[model samples]
Target chain A: MISAKLKERLIFIGPLIVLPGLIVAWPVLEVLWLSFRNRVQIFHIDRWVGAANYLYLFGEDLRFASAVSNTLYFTFVSVGLEFLLGLGFALYLRFSPEREWVKGMMLIPWVIPSVVSARLWQWMLHAEAGIVNYLLQSVGLTDAPIPWLSSPDLALHAAIFADVWKTTPLMVLLLYAGLLGIPENLLRAARVDRTPPFRMLFCILIPQLRPAIATAVVLRLLDAFRVFDVIYVMTGGGPANSTETLSLYAYRTYFQSLQFGYGSSVVVVQVMILAGLTAVAYRLLQGKNPAAAGDGPGEFHPRRTEVKE
Target chain B: MVPVKRKPIFRVETMARILIRSLAVLAILAGCARSGPLPDENKTVHYYQFSLPRDREAFDRLRTWFHEEHPEVNLQIHTLPTSSDDQHQFYLTHLGSRSLSRIDVFALDVIWLAEFARAGFLMPLDDLFPEREWEEFFPAPVQAATYDRHRYAAPLFVDAGVLYSRKDLLLKHGFAHPPKTWEELVKASRVILEREEDPSLNGFVWQGKQYEGLVCNLIEFLPSRNPFLTVAESPRLEVDRVRRALGFMRDLVVRFGVSPPSVFSMSEEESRQVFQNGRAVFMRNWPYAWRLAQQEGSPVKDRVWLSPLPAFAGDASGGKGALGGFLLGIHPESPAREEARAWVRFLASPRAQRVLWQDLGLTPARRTVFPDLPSRGIPLDVLRQVMESAVPRPASPLYIPISQSVQAYGSGALAGVYPIDRAIRHIESDMGRIMRVMH
Candidate 1:
């Protein structure tokens, strides 16, 4: 009963459905199933414990609570700083006379692998031999060396600083691309109308770049949420677990502790939290864009959309 | 309209072509996914172990010896990551996936013996060594390699914590011998720091980091009669002694002001670097630091000496170093069980142990090999004594979690983030919970 046209359509679309189902959906479902069991692989303890793991995480495990707070704090602070710094760099690159060289130089941090950068930062932040401490001491900034990675109060922030340094270049690249996409005529018109630079930035440039900013922020937010390598290298969630993010906690539980079921539960909750964040972000970012509402390419046309003038 | 009609036909043809090519690539990939090596004339046995750059020459020698010993076995050696944590994770992933046949023989850290054995990842090695043969290796490492009264691995090499001191500094400060007790160490360090009046020099440095090394240091700090935890019956932490040990650790930083605040972040390498640079009066580390301290370019060359770690003044038994080293074991699921056992036996032999000691500076687990090697110095005698007194960490299948609890709360206490009593209570309760769940 299959028509020739329908057969062709099915042939083209079948892999798209089958591939993700096998690769992504299957593992996710397996983990979700595991979350409901009390499965400690080493001990050969496997049984249905329905919500017991979740209950422990929510009601009892103090480490889980700290991990949640640490993840959120790390994600938001690092992403916020990255956005501001990235926007500033992007704007400078767009207007600077030495744009090509400056852009190339900015990519050094991004191009270096995160683990290497983290190790580099670890050495630089060492309380005794670190260049950062050495410089600070020489400049009479502080008498005692700051225990950047060792102190519980400062370890998470130190990790965040490393994360921002490594990833800010990515934000700059994306935002700069967005800047390049803005139509030239619109900015020319703003200049002709005698609009101030600040006003033009807020009214003309920002509104035009909303889609790009949203994309960059959401991308960085996703990356920052599941951060593992930098913190793993720098603090190892140590100095009393102050820098322990959810991903690190899950890794420690699943791999180190061999509490596979509880670890899966942590993962499931992390995914759910990430999903909720992504959805909210998508709605908030795409809500105002006419292109997102299916208004077509003409939405960006100067004549079709109202100009502030 | 004619061009648009042709577009659909063009798209269909291209899609079908792409699909065919993708299927071919995937089929080729799938063909290559078969496990284990191809069948060969010689029996293939895969060996996995971590080797540092310095140990490469020694390992090469051992490999040549192994090949000569077992020409019928095709021994493929794989270098694992140097970090113990990474190597542990690598084994967990492969073994957890039930890909057991991929690795026939592997080296395990001393602390991982019980955990790996209890998980049924290792082959029982009792048949490889007789009761008398077991006595050839150090008793501590032999004890560590056993689980549930069954031997699971063969001791390869041994390590124990020792105190490395600046010989000139101690003598200059009027101390004729190394400190025999913790009280003497503290008093000597105070005198040296005051008379030397060096702002950059620290009185003592040891691993206080929140890692397995911290547990090792803590074990050495505790009285020999009282261990941090006992797993003989139900697991229990000796709270009072642990508190006193942890209090002493914290006092070194917060009270004594002898050890740097940075000790809270140091590992073996960091502490060794400080000692080698001659910036610390005394350092708690392993025998390997001796070779490094005496290296040609080291600032402390010829001026450093080692002794057993100091004990509390009241304890007559003196200090106890935490035993550490690698052990060789066979994978139970490997089809080449005979070859795997042979490989382990060859590696643990006295000849191989001597090569390892002479070339790599690792303390051989075999007591007989010690006499065969040339005399290095007085440090060799001290290492032998320390190895005799070395105590193994608790032999429990739940050692990883137990260690984690100790590292977290213990470091918390040492870093002044948590009170010692509270940290001890937390560690005890955590261990109790771990035992209940795993049991």
Candidate 2:
């Protein structure tokens, strides 16, 4: 009794569903399986260690704990700063009358490559003859030159500063898009109701932009957690291992130490952390969905008449 | 909307299809221009060279020299960080890979050939160069290059650690000449410190950074002590003499106060700059600084003096300095292995050696290059003295770990974190574990 067109539609969608399963899901599952294997020498699955690698990481490797802590510290701090800055920029751009050239000019930092940006920052941060120290000294801010990359305490902060410089523009653009998509009538209504600026932002704008913020936060958090290139170029985790991130640790384990088995375990550890964070974010977003729905009026009826008008 | 125009649109579509087909054919033909199968005989040579920032010009010259000799071969050169340990990491990555294209020729440290040869990274050079050609080279350097009765690399250059002093400072200290013994050196440093008006000025400066230099400085003084680096007929380390050596370094920093407190962070270049700026009275550095100090516009252009590292308690054995230099090793993966060998042989020839020495201020590997040349600004007798006393670092695959342990443990004492004895004990135990694992 099925129509030919309907049957063809079902047939067309069947392959699409299976294609994603075959491409992405299947490979991710394979990585999960391989991570449990004892060794990956020559890509052979020699034995099953059954969580022993994970156990050894938490139990014996002190560097694992330090790297994990450092990664988390970077993720939260840098993402938080970038979020505030991006939100502020998005608000400013949304309210202000935009000049065409100004909009184009704001995209420069985001457009440049991360490696090139990092190298530029590195030159500025050099201890002896760098511009940063030169300016600081000229202003009489401090009597001595600060060792930005040379000191353990300052190295991580320096790396974070570089990461913020390169990535904040991305956050701003995403938030700006979310802001533009917000209905202008809702904001106008809030102002008419005598709602203050802060209250309007918290009650109307933020609830509406929850989906966008969640998406942007997850993306930026993932990037900050796995920040490798800038840190690798800046410090290489020296001055007594103060700036060691999880990715750099994994790299050293695999490349420098040549312990592929252990290195894979480190990678698995990072993957688990990222996956857990994503899951938590998903649940939080889902939990807030009900609140977002509550802000809207009853929506069972379609506004066909209003649309026609 | 316009039926008459539809005919023209259909005709244009047909013409566009024809043009697209023609363009595709042209693109394929252009790609095919260079897509023919590579010949079986052609081989690519991948050479990895590690050098300092100052040697970029010399490296370019060497590149041109290599290119002319092998016109048919493809050549790749990888410039690495100036740090030798970091360069070793680059080698580790390639050797760990199962691929042959990773690298073809590795310019190795003289001491590294032993460990690398044992690890199967280096190909035996007997097939490329005859024994007589190698015999003409210095025995000690050749010995340093050999492991397990097989020659792994040919000596490329010789770097001798020497005492660099300010000639003006020595004269100001009531001594017209540089010190030759530990006692004399310390006395001169005290005199200079007493007379120098600036509080920031240092009497002595050397590499105390947590690196191979600390171990080298410690080893030079090991032979003068009662114990030695190794036990007879055993691989186990001699702990007591090693402690004495560590103790001596600590005294140099703390008890003597001749060296700067910031010595813990000073590398070769930093210490050199400190001395070259006329800030320090004496310095310990390799011969490369001789050229830099003599270069135009140097602050200490005419004020620098060079001599052997002062002996401890006037003992020759205690003053034994470690020989450091680069060596050339053929990569097992080199496609133009025979051609690469010919070029390497040319590089080692007396003609090339002499040219490198006279023109570039580079220390040549061959003994003949030394006796025939009386290069201006470098005293010939000083060269002979360094060659006679050159000692090689300990050859072991465990050297990497040993060097790290030495750096980590002794760095505490260098930074005034722990006492010398405590640091020595830590180093001994660390070395023990490393040796056990490596063996």
Candidate 3:
């Protein structure tokens, strides 16, 4: 027989569960359905073409391939740099006795909105009148000013640098929390054992902070893979489409080109790639620990027994 | 075991209390954001428009006048994005839906007439705009507003591509006249650049970005040779003429080095900035730049010279400006057709045309409205010549995709990424595919 508590919980939770289902899942499901159907004329007519859109993305369009590679390149470079920088900052803050004030100041870049940050970076990197060029020229770096936004080779790197600047603070905050959660006794034990500083980081500290590193990297990877605003504001995916990320490509196809059939396919491919990466991340983080199997707020296990000062 | 002081209940109570208080405050703030709803009205005309930089003051004046005079009709104005690409996409999102949008009147770009009309987003204005009334606007703008034998819109204003030059700079370099052809333009620019040792100064500047501005630049160049080939006849593209014209454009910057590589990052305003500061000897831009160049504090003030965009040396059409203008149309799904039609009629009137000319410096689409104004300035004379000899872009329903293809390939050529010949071939083939789909 069902307990009275169980029946009461079901009655309370049923409507609450449906709220998220309606808000998020329903639209995602609708777009998924649209991916299967071919939009013959605007959104009025639809013809069923199962997996045809997916096949076209892989087989037919060179733009889709280029966009995929560009997105991956952006993701890999951006997340990798952010990780190293964030870890470095977090480690410094942890070891330094008088870094509380500096820690607050460092979060300012992350606090500023993304669009505002992007526009600021765009002005700073302006080829003719920007201060960056002015400084470079004053120091006798080169005789000619660099075309930061106009050149195909330089546009991607300029945009990547901007993304790295905007996101590294987030990584620092997350990794700092993980750094604090480490037990003091363990560090003392390592000190007693005379373990080298690098070994302590790679073997003990990093292994224990696996969950936070996983969260930070996966979040940044997902965000970077579909980058739009920084690239849009700075390069506009131009100079021979050098900085066109997957999100910008999908947006251009759906809105500018008015090709719903193909645009939805781009979105579907992005989702598939993100899901695969996330699953791999989850598996890697779970490493011999079944209790810490899930991601996100409620599902994630509290691995810390004590918060070190 | 030690008895623990577990304060979970008290902590939960405090959090719940704070959450409830914040929710109430947020609810009050949300209410403060919105005023009372409008009263029930029979006619509510929602005018949707892209926000042109120069037209804001005129738009506000017109909106106020229309509302104050006609109390029975609720005339509201909505501003779309300034960028044409974004504005086009915004309209498509609303108009492409299965249901009717709330927008009653649409102030359209000239290139959008074919697309919106073919898609049935626009109501034919043949009934609303009679022949006598339609003939008031210039023929080129009228022609641009027409599609499938139906007048889809009434012309609002005129914009034609023109070349702006510094008269003092040219005279200093010993040139008595403006360049009449591509070859002459290059020769004139080179001489000026050689004499002026300023690294900031350039021979010429124009928009070369991968956008609609880039398409405008390419269009001004391409048709001067054949004068007959257009994307309207894309399947039968003249590859050789296109190659020559594009080669001329690319050679201006890449080969000749008259323009900076940064031109690829510029639009109309950026190029204007380069020329208005006396850094550029000449700039290819629209008539709006004339007003800005003639501003009091401008470095090139009173030294400005305007001319028609130069053609090839042997071309029949001398300095043919590409046709560009605005059109106002009615939405077929509008519930307030009467009010919307009245708004359109008011805009096309003599009073409206005068303000558009005098206040905003937008070249009036009406022939009789600003006939005497051309005699007032040299720029006005050049403007008149360009308007008279203008050629419209291909009135295709697939203009968005067609223009995208041109921007991609054209920008490739200008950026030195793709060779001019290869770029021409790609544009022709891509445009051929678009034409087949259109047919």
Candidate 4:
């Protein structure tokens, strides 16, 4: 015997749970199961190995350590730079007279598929014939062309640079929306009191945009941590695996090396790390912005208002 | 008022009918999608191979000929990505499922024969071909296709790395011939670089990118004993040779400065571009580069000459190049086993090989096809010599992991990122781990 309200809630929320369970949870559980077995498909070896795969990854595989470090470096640096650049761009566009036109143009980099952009960067970073080198040499910046994609010292940074270029616009879009959600009257009131621009940004705008910033940073961090296409197209984890990230390493193990169990374990560990980070990030961000957890001026419920309309 | 009250019920009935009709259509569409396109009267045999845009016409002609010969069999061609790594991944995903019987026949790299054979993906060809038929192809490719004394594939074509030199550059430097040994090559390159005084010019170029090509280059650079062979027999002896070989490769760029710093990044096409543009004095590449270099308007077209790769001084195995090329194998789970066998046999036939060579510049695996064909400005005799001395990479089911370990460590050593000794140690350990786990 269900109440009318309870039955209505079940009708609305039931599919949301079942759909994700079927599509996402099932495959994840399968991979978890696979991670515990010694499954080398090519060798026809499938047996319960328990923690051996994880042990080997942590203890014996030097590449796995490097891959973890590379992934973290790529994620933090790329996401950090993107947040800063995106915030700056979002603010500038909000105030600029040609805001719509500039915003549209800013989307070109983000709009292009990552694989295509990576290929373009690969050509532009070509040591001998690339335009970047040509410009650098012509300006007397350096006599020899920099091996952007080839040098082990510089390849990961090159990948990060590409990631930043391609993804910063997403941050801009999110932050810009966050900016728009801010009540104009608050800024008007601050201006009436003779508030300085810097103070307004630090004390008002940033505090108001905390939720957006956190969401954008976490989203980009997760995406960048699992980055494969751009780096794959550009360096292929080469010049001695300097650009190899966790996802690339896992893929190589699964597909190229045919070590399904080991690859699964690598991915499982990566997922655990991601989950921990996401939890910490959500908590820290939400702790700072209590309004995100309740109905407050900072929280914009567009859907609720639209539903009433 | 009564008619209006009944109108709502009628509308509901019509709406439900439309919904049911659309859902039935969707269900039919989904069924079609699952079983693939509508069935044809002719028996279909699916074939998968890498795309070669340049040889599309030749391939079409071969398909037409195949269809004419076997009118009952419908040959469906599917093109895999050109990269061997991608193709290998595609096969692994498709064949691992054991349900993708649509792929009746596929092209396989020589090194993948052992792995695929061991995985039970490929059908043994021992019953398909007799002793006389097997003898038609070269021994190297034949040997490469066999695992546990059972032939698993039919060699469709063969490739061997060869040295391409600028005849004009060598003559200008007062050399009668291309370098016979690695020592002579370095000396000649030094002299040529000094005499030419061209900043754009490089002494030599080869595939040094961190991939399978690097492994091939490593094999070519090693001393006559073959380090890979010694690894199984005497691991101690292999270590020193591998170190020496790797050191010399690094020295060519760092110490001699002849092979430019950029060679660390160059693959076959990039190195060929340098040599073809007359910026490189010598290049090490596969036989395919010969046709490209001799094409009209190439800067070094008339001046280029092909020769065997140089070896260490006094090494008897100086001329050996790494064996490469593709073979055709039948899927063990394929429903149309007879049709797949026919397709593989047809592709490896002498007539088919001749067409592939004449039309597509592929080096034929059949020894008989080489006798009567016009050379078309290519040095056939020199190619034959290189092919005769061609050595295959280490034959093992674990070759992919082994190759990956070699490429990673070797590239690290070449780039000065990892010390040579450390790289070697990593390689040995990685190989040991791979072999242990697989076994």
Best by lDDT: 1
lDDT of 4 by residue, A110-207 (tens): 99999999999999988877899999999999997899988888999999999899999999999988887776666667888989999999988998
State the weakest 10-residue window (summed lDDT) of model 3 chain B. B225-234
Please give the lDDT score at residue A153 for candidate 4. Answer: 89
Please say which candidate is ahead in TM-score: 2 or 4. 4
* Candidate 1 structure quality by residue, lDDT tens digits, A1-309: 999999999899989999999999999999999999878776688888788778877975667888999999999999999999999999887765546668789999999999999999999998878999999999999988899998899999999999999999999999987887777677777789989989988877777788998999999889999999999998899878889899999999898988788889999999999999988987887788745656457546432222233
What do the candidate models score in CA lDDT, each in turn?
0.86, 0.72, 0.78, 0.85
TM-score of chain A of each: 0.93, 0.84, 0.86, 0.90
- In TM-score terms, which candidate is top? 4
| Candidate 1: Cα lDDT at A91 | 88
Q: What share of the true interface contacts does candidate 3 keep?
A: 0.42
**Chain A accuracy of model 1 expressed as TM-score:** 0.93
Off by over 4 Å in 1: A1-18, A96-98, A183-185, A287-299, A302-309, B1-45, B54-76, B94-102, B333-342
Q: What is the C-alpha lDDT profile of model 3 across A124-163, one tens digit per residue?
A: 9988777888899999996788888888889889999999
- Lowest summed lDDT across 10 adjacent residues in model 4 chain A is found at A300-309
Per-candidate Cα RMSD to the true structure, in Å, reads 6.2, 7.9, 5.4, 6.8
TM-score of 4: 0.88
Model-by-model DockQ, in order: 0.30, 0.15, 0.32, 0.40
Chain B, TM-score, each prediction? Answer: 0.88, 0.82, 0.86, 0.87
Q: Higher TM-score: candidate 3 or 4?
A: 4
- In model 4, pairs of residues that clash are none
